[model samples]
Every structure is written in C-alpha cells, then in structure tokens.
Target: MNVPAYAGPSSVTTRSGDALSLPAPRQDSEFSIERALHERRSVREFGKTALTQDEVSQLLWAAQGITSRDGLRTAPSAGALYPLELYLVVGMVRDLDPGVYRYAPAGHKLMKIIAGDQRHKLASAAHGQDCVADAAAVLVFTAVERRTTRKYGSRGVRYVHIETGHASQNVFLQATALDLGTVVVGAFEDDAVGKVLQLPEGEVPLYLMPLGRP
Candidate 1:
C-alpha cells in the first residue's frame, strides 16, 4: 500500500500523510434507536447525490471508532484484541477524492491506500452487484484472526465473526439514523477482494457495506 499521507487544507499533514482529519462524531441525535431498528432495511438502489464528509466520518466512527478513553471500540472484541480493520471505498463523497482509504480509528483519520474509483472492480469482485459500484461509498471490513486466536484458541474465530455482526449492525443503525441507505454484502470472492484492494498480508476481507441515499 502506498504510504503518501495527506490531509485536507484545513489541517496540517503529519509525517504519515494522514489524509483527512475526521470531524468529531456526534454523540447525540434526534434519531432514536427504536426508529432506526424499525426503519432499517437493506438498500440496493442509491441516488446520485454525493454524501458529505461528516456523513463519512460518522459511519466510520460507528463501525469501529474509539468510544472510550480506555481504548475500547464501538464493538466488543474477544480479550479486547480489536482485530478489525475498515476501508472506505469513496466514489462520490463531497470534499473527498475517490479512492480506497484505510481508517485509522485512533486518530479518526483516513489514510489513502490508493487513488481512483475501484467500485466497479469491487462490483465485479462481488459477482456483478451493481450496488457495489452505485453507492456513494462502501465500508469494507477486514479482520486479523490471529489477534484473537492466539489467546482464545480456535474459538476466537467464532468471537471475531460475532464481533463483526455487532460492528456491522452499528453501521446499519447509524445509516438509518443519518437517513442513508446501505446494505451489508457478503457474497464475494475473498481472494478477489483482497486482490482488488491489494490488501496487506493477514488481512482477511469480511463484509462489504455500500452506503448512499435511497
């Protein structure tokens, strides 16, 4: 992965070329959990409007942002060995370049792994699901099983899957609250996805959630 760090004009670029400084996640909102749950549904069709930077920030925060001072994430991990990694496939987000970005939850920042719209390739990797390309952005979830397996034995695999469900659900409810449409797509060739993103070693792609306006 290319390491050229970047930052929006508003913030100074650090030595790591951290792409964008994410807006602080809102802690309170008028949207309630009950409503989000009731309205939540898989959205395959999306509008052409580009999503705002804040929206992108919120979704990443929901997925796996730091929620506490103790380093606990939004999702519970086995032995607190957070092994999940999030990648944002930006297609039509406002003030953001199109590219594959690695989410650094610690700084609430994104590091561009590569540039260009890889959504169509992702759609192809996902067996021609157009939604993969149509959406404004996709939040890709990957995991390092060894982080948990080292301590919990093979049962750690089960824990990681369970944590994925928790984290993805957070994405679902957060999208609903933000009035954004999204779907968790699991049907894809793992190796194909790995190749498309040129994922680093030991990072296994798990879920693909495309987000957009309905």
Candidate 2:
C-alpha cells in the first residue's frame, strides 16, 4: 500500500500572480449524512448563483481531502494506491478566478493548470451536454493507471474505476449537504476531455461532475 507521492509541481501561478490556496474546509457541518443521501438526486439544471470558495473547498475535500496526517484521503483506494486525480473547471465561484485547477489533496490546495473559462469547450466534449457548461464548476476525475497497475497489473484498471466511483459519490453527498446540485457525467469523448484539460501523459479522464446551486 505504498502510494507514490504526487509528481506535479506543488503550485502554479496565475496570470495575476495569485496563488491557489483555498479556504480552509469546515470540519463541522450541520448537514447530516442521512439527509444528504435522502435529498441527493441527479440534477442536470442549475441556478445562476455563484458558489462560495468555502463551498468549493468542502466539495474538493469531501471528494479526496486528506483526512489523516499520514496522507490518507476521504475515499478508500485499493492497496492505498490512489490513482485518481481531481481537476476543477471553474466558472462562477466567488472569490476565485475561473480556470482549470488540479487538486492537491495532500496540501489541500489547487494548482492552476490553465486560466480562462473552458466550460463551453468541456460541454462540447461531453457530447454538448449543457450541464457541463451551465454549472458553476465541473469536477473532472482522471486516473494514472500505472499508479495501480504497477502493483495489481491489468486488474488495477478496475480498482482505479472503483476508487473513482467512491470519490464521485462523496461529491454527490457533499453537494447535497451544501444544498447544491450535481450530476455524474460519464458520457464524453475521452480523448476530447484529455485535450481540453491538457492532461499529462499516463493520465486518463474517467468521470465529470458538474456542480451548482439548483
């Protein structure tokens, strides 16, 4: 269960010289898990309200936030080989610039990858799904197969996908708790998504969850 450390640069600068430090995630939530599960639904439509930075932080944290000091995430992984990587396509988040950002789970920060609104392009890649473009933000889950394959061989691919499901479900529950809406989108041209995110080699796109106020 020896997961390798993340290989990307610790941080990246925006055109405005701004760093990607996110608001501290609130540990205490009034929303109960039972309520979250009961209220959770596949919401394809979204309101125009912009999400707050704190909301974004909580959502990311729920998806893959570091829970233990030893670098374990909120979601379980096969052999602790966490192959899933999180990227955000932000559009209308308050106090945060719209751009593509990679989540650093260990550090609880985001690294800017590309700046500008790419939601429209992402929507096109998702077979013209308006939810991808209309939501305030989209969470893209990608996986580096070798992270698990190096240990479990071809069967590792299944492990990676299973892990992503766990993470995506975490987002769904969290969004419900936050009174936001989200839908897990698996219909997309994989290659098209990779190009839109400018993903590095060894990474493959898996799931896209668009989030916003319902």
Candidate 3:
C-alpha cells in the first residue's frame, strides 16, 4: 500500500479525476424503489467507467447514514443499538486512493485505513472473484456484536444480521438507481477480511457487495 506524502486531492475536490459534477438527486417522480428493484441485477462484468467520490458518499449515506438528530441510521437497529459498521474497498473509483476505508456513518466520511490497490488481494481473499478485482468499489458490511448483544442478549446477534440485510438492500437499490451494478457476496474468509480492514476482534464481517458500472 503506497501512502504518498500528499496522497492526491481530498475526496471532495477530485471527482474521479474528471471535472467535478454532481449526480442528480433521486427525485420522487423519477427514482422509485420499486423501479430500481425491477432493474436490479447482479452484474459481474463492468466497464472501466469510474465512480465519483460524491457518488460514493451518496451511496454510503443511503446505506447507513445518520437519519436523525440522535444518530439514528437509515435502517432500524434492534433497540437502536446500531452494530453494523460499513467499510469501503475501493478499486477503480477515480481521484481517490485505492484502499479500505471505514465509513463514518455519523459524519458521512471515509476514514482511510490501509491505502493503495488492495483489491487484488481482496479478490484473492474472496476465492478469486474477478468482480472483486474489477469493481469500482466494494462495500463490506461488518458488525460489532456487543452493540446489539448488550441489549438483546444472545438473540441480539440475530437482529444485527437482519439489520445488515436492510442496509445491503438499501445499497442495492441506490446503486441500481445510479445505473451502477452490484452483487452481494457472502462467501469469504471472515478473518482474512478483518485483517485487511484492520477491524477489531469483535467486529465481524457479515456481507460484501461489489459495485461498478455495468
């Protein structure tokens, strides 16, 4: 992982190295969840078209951003004990460093962890899925067990998994609306991913969704 001294421009200024542009917000009349669901498919092959940082921000926001003044997320957590932690495994996203970054849901920002093209390693870790290698970005759904367990006891673990599904669905629909492709990947070595993302012991990988232009 190459961490350049400057490490390029911040995520805000560089929109995939192209001129800064914003994607049109999902309009009530234009973008419908039902429509996106109908159009959603697991796209394994992708064009080399790069995704912008703004696009990533919006996608992450939809996945699990704070939706209220009290730090409630987009998905309902059991007892409001939000346990799901989002991580982005960026590959081809333009203008951003390639690496794993934890998604800070409260502030809606990427906290860079290991930097530089770790996607190839992730691909190998994911049982040699070329999509993991080629994706513009991969969103990892991880959970800190005790966040929910502390509230609901052992059964809280079940609720946490359900919450993760809700978040992943949100990403799927949002990506579909953006005309991007996404596929949910569950087969992988959890320990390997945790090491790659530098997650703590209790933070467990629950799901992986690789995203890119179809």
Candidate 4:
C-alpha cells in the first residue's frame, strides 16, 4: 500500500545519558491487511533474530502513531482522551541500547526511562513466560485512568481497557505484516510490573506483548 512519509523533525535525544533518537517510521507497506489478518497468530516462541530499528518504529506507530495532522491515532480512544501509554522493554533491537523506553507518540520517538535490559525481570513478573525474555522487545501497554475517568467517571475504567485492546490488536496485525511473532500476555503481576518498569504513580500496566522474528 502507498502510505505518506513523515516530513517532520528528525529524531533527537533531549538530554544526555542513554536517551537516543529512533528512526522515523515508514508509512508505506507492501503487506496487505487481509494477509496480515489471515496470518496473525498468538506466537509464543520466537527466533533469535534481532528486530531492526525500522521494525520497532513501525510497530510503535501501529500501536499509537499519529495518523493525521490532527493527531488521530491508529487505535480508537474513548472521548479522544487517549489514556493508553506504551513502553518498550528492549532486549535485542538493532542500533538500540537495551533498556526501557517510553513511546512518545506525539513526537514519533522514544524517551529512555531505564537503562539495561529488564526482560528477565519482566518475564518473572509474567509468571515465567519465556517469550517475555526471548523476544527482541516487549511492548508494555499502560493507562492513566484519570485521563478518561474524570470525563467518563467510573465507566471510563472500561473505556481505558477497551482502548488497550485496540492498541494490542494493532500490534498483532503489524507484527504479522512484518513476519514477526508476538503474543498478548495479560497474566502478569500488576504490582511487579509497575515496580519493574518504575511506572509513574498514576499509570498502571494493562497488557504486555512480546515480539520478535518467528
């Protein structure tokens, strides 16, 4: 498919330390939606191949990239609050230091949160799921309930979850298109995940997706 290119600012680190820029996401893809859907599977095993920076960019874009000048994302959000926040637990991505990076969707870049690979800890929090440690990277989806809760009240809780589902499905479809393997891991200890990622006080972990070459 013919997709538009991003003619925005180049990726740059805001400060010193491990913070680094990510490659711009490629808008075009030859992969067909029908084929991706047909091939999509909950893959638990992954090959040792390291994911490229472009693949990482594309996956993050699929999850929460801005699709228009107005900043509409690939996934739908309740009341357009966009409560979901994406984190990358890196292990084996090319040209990227292993660590936890937060996805800055507005900038289409990543901000380093914690340095060093934490895949093993994440796998432990995920109840010994090898995929968490084996995959090149794991996408951790979290949410700030107050962003939607204040607008929708208690029902906003459900909306945040639904939004996460939409984002997770986008990752699955994108992984399929890229010939990568991934699985949605929801059976993790919430507190453990929070501690491992050192999440902000208000954000809470909702879903974990481990992705790599199949």
Candidate 5:
C-alpha cells in the first residue's frame, strides 16, 4: 500500500497571495486504519464548536493532497488525469473567514471564491438537510468529466465515479482518526448544488461531506 507522503511548507513553492497556506499534514497518527474503519459511522449530529485550521488541513489532505512529487494524490485517478475539484463551504472554522473556498492540492492551500457563510443556502440546496447547515464546514466534491472522458471515452464516466468513492472514503477514514464526525451526502439536486458553489461549466458535483466535532 502506498501511504500519503507529507510535503511540508518548505516543499510548497507555487502559491498565490490570495490562497491560505495550510499547515503541514502529519503522517504519524496514533489512530490506525483498522480502528478508523471499525469506528467510522455516518455522523449527522454535530457540536456547535468551531473547527481548527489544522483539522481542516488534515481532512483536505486525506481527500486530495498531492502525495508525491509527480502530483500523485491520496486518491488514484485513471490515467493519472485528476478531474476532481474540492470546494469548502466554510461556516465556523477558527481564524478562518466564512466563505466559499477552493482547495488546490498542489500547494495545499485554499483560495477564497465567495465571501460570508453560505451553509444555510447550501443546506437549502441540499433539499433542506440539517446536517449540511449544522456542520462547521462542508467539503464539496466536483469533477470535470472531460478530464477523464476525453481519453477513455464513454467508460471514463465510470472512472470518475470510482475516483470519487476513493477520495470520499479517505475523508471518512481521516475524520474517524481525528475524532470528527462526517457523513457523505449524495442526495441533492445537481443544478442546485452547482449554483450553491457557483461551479464552473462542465464541473459536476459528486458529493457533499459535512464535517465537525460529534
């Protein structure tokens, strides 16, 4: 098994002024995969406390942080053509402004796309699921199909879905390790979600993961 390699701040060279630099992800953890898997559950109830930036960083890192110098991420992609994009709907994170932010795994940083908390709107878009509104932060997963389909043709669509499962599961396990509650939510209107994130054309929303202290 290829584990996620940690690339500290010293290794991150490309970053824009607007992007918030993330803390280095710790590879060593007392929690083991077997334990995380045994304990992993779909968490809907969450605490009102705000999440720390380090927790946010670890979660995002598990989802899609680059694990190697060649840009190989925590999750594998078909043909190494990563089509997935991660967006965060920030609500109650410490020291972080509430807004819509995009995660760039290459630099392990967040770029603000929209200002203010939009979690309520997102919950509405998610068919009024309270979990979406209650979590301190929600990670929205999107994909540009053409990145994979352009090469694999019709079958590439399946590859995108498989990649999504891989990425989402990583978050689940990482959440368990951090003692955070998270659940993968897929029941939502496509158009509504795209609008909530103001996603670009061709980027399809695949999953909504609301995360916070249980």
Candidate 6:
C-alpha cells in the first residue's frame, strides 16, 4: 500500500517502520506457495546480505496483517477474535535502521521498543540458537490471551498456537517466494521477550521466526 520513512529511535512512530513503496518482485517468483511448502526447510545458516524495508513489509503483510477492507487478517482466528500481536527484532537490514519493533498489522507500521542490535540477547533467550544472531531479522509472535480466552476458555490456548502456525506458514512461504531463509524458534524466555517488547501482562509470546539471506 504505502511506504513511509522511519524516523529513528526518539522519532520511532510505531513498532516496525511503515511499509514503503518499492519495486515488486518479477512476474516470476523463486517459488510458488506449493513449491515453497515442498522445499521449505529451517535454514539456520545465512548469508551476510541484509533485508530491505520492502522485504520486511512484504513479510509482515504475509504474516498476520489485515488484508480486507473490514480489517480481516491474512491468518485465521478462532471466533474471529484475533489475539496475535507480532514484533520484529531487527539485527541487520539495508536502507533502514535496526531496532526491536512491534508490527502494527492494520497500519503496516512499526513501533520501536528498543534501539540497536540485540540479537545476542534474543539468541540467548531462544535457548542459544545461533540463527537468532545470524538471521537478519527475528519475528516474535505474541498473543493477548483475553481476546480468545474470553470466548473459548482454556481451549483458546490451542487456537492461539494454531493461528500462530498460520501466520508462521505465511512468513515461510513468503520467504521462499522471495528467495530468503527463515527458521522458527519455539524455545525462548517468554518473560524476557515480553520485557524486550514491553508487552502488557496479558500478552504472551508464542513463536519466534528468524529471516535472512540463505
């Protein structure tokens, strides 16, 4: 849609920067959705090439962003109660700055939490996964329990994970199509990630996906 400039740190408007207008991929992509699914693998090793702002925008859009006029999302939700909140831990990217941002799916913007590189901390939190540091960006998915729990009670927890799976699959497919690499990390210090993202008490971290050049 729109591509907006990110005013660094003190001027950080939202989590992740606003989507910027950039060149779209060629008519032919590296992989189709079905092909991507067939070829998908957790690529822990990454090249030094950094992701561009447009790539980040496309990735977030594919994940859980709103796609419909009524704010309907790309990922399915239980009872249509969307409980997932996405965050971006940017380590290295070109044509933009780096920081920990919250992905505002509706506005397609980012709210910065902390500035500078913190992949080491994320790697440590993710059970010493070097990929967290090697990858250019790490996407953190959090769920606001009340959104679903109010309807499905404790069973809502399962739905949240299912919804996260949908969102993660979107990222994986998008990565494959864009010729990038991605890895999902389940082990992490939830409280620590929440601290890093400045999440509220009811918001719980669920999944972590790192993206980079393969």
All candidates: TM-score: 0.92, 0.91, 0.86, 0.91, 0.92, 0.85
**Tens digit of lDDT per residue, candidate 1, span 1-214?**
1212233222232325646688789988999999999999999999877777788889999999998899999888889999899999988877787889999999899998888889999999999999998998899999999999999999998999999999999999999999999999999999999998899898899999999988
Tell me the spans in candidate 3 whose CA falls farther than 4 Å from its real position. Answer: 1-29
CA shift of 85, model 6, Å: 0.6
Q: Which ranges in model 2 have alpha carbons more than 4 Å from their true place? A: 1-19
lDDT of 5 by residue, 1-214 (tens): 2213322212232346778888889988889899999999999988777777889999999999999999999999999999999999988787678889999898799998998889999999899999999999999999999999999999999999999999999999999998899999999899998988999999999999999888
lDDT of 3: 0.78
User: Candidate 1, TM-score vs. the true structure?
Assistant: 0.92
lDDT of 3 by residue, 145-185 (tens): 89889878999989998998898888888888888888998
- The per-residue C-alpha lDDT of model 1 at residue 32 equals 93
Q: Write the residue-wise lDDT of candidate 2 on 1-214 in tens digits.
A: 2223323222222323334777788877788899998988999998777777788999999999999978888999989888999999988887667889999886678888998889999999999999999998999999999999999999999999999999999999999988899999999999999999999998999999999888
Residue-level lDDT tens digits of model 6 in 1-214: 2323333323322332344233322234546678888878878888767777778888888887777798898889998899999888887766546778777765667766777777888888788898888888899889997899899999998998899999999889888887788988898898887776778889999988989888
Write the candidate numbers in order of decreasing lDDT. Answer: 5, 1, 2, 4, 6, 3
In model 3, how large is the Cα lDDT of residue 74?
78
Error of 4 at 124 (Å): 0.6
Q: Evaluate model 1: give its lDDT.
A: 0.88
- What are the lDDT scores of the predictions, listed in order? 0.88, 0.88, 0.78, 0.87, 0.90, 0.78
How many pairs of residues collide in model 1? 3
Question: For residues 12-31, could you state the per-residue lDDT of candidate 4 as single tens digits?
Answer: 33434444556677776888
For model 2, state the Cα shift of residue 16 in Å.
Answer: 12
The candidate 4 region of ten consecutive residues with least summed lDDT is 1-10
Clashes of each: 3, 0, 1, 0, 0, 9
Q: Candidate 4 local accuracy as lDDT?
A: 0.87
In model 2, state the lDDT of residue 115. Answer: 86
List the RMSD of every prediction in angstroms. Answer: 5.7, 8.0, 6.2, 5.7, 6.5, 5.2
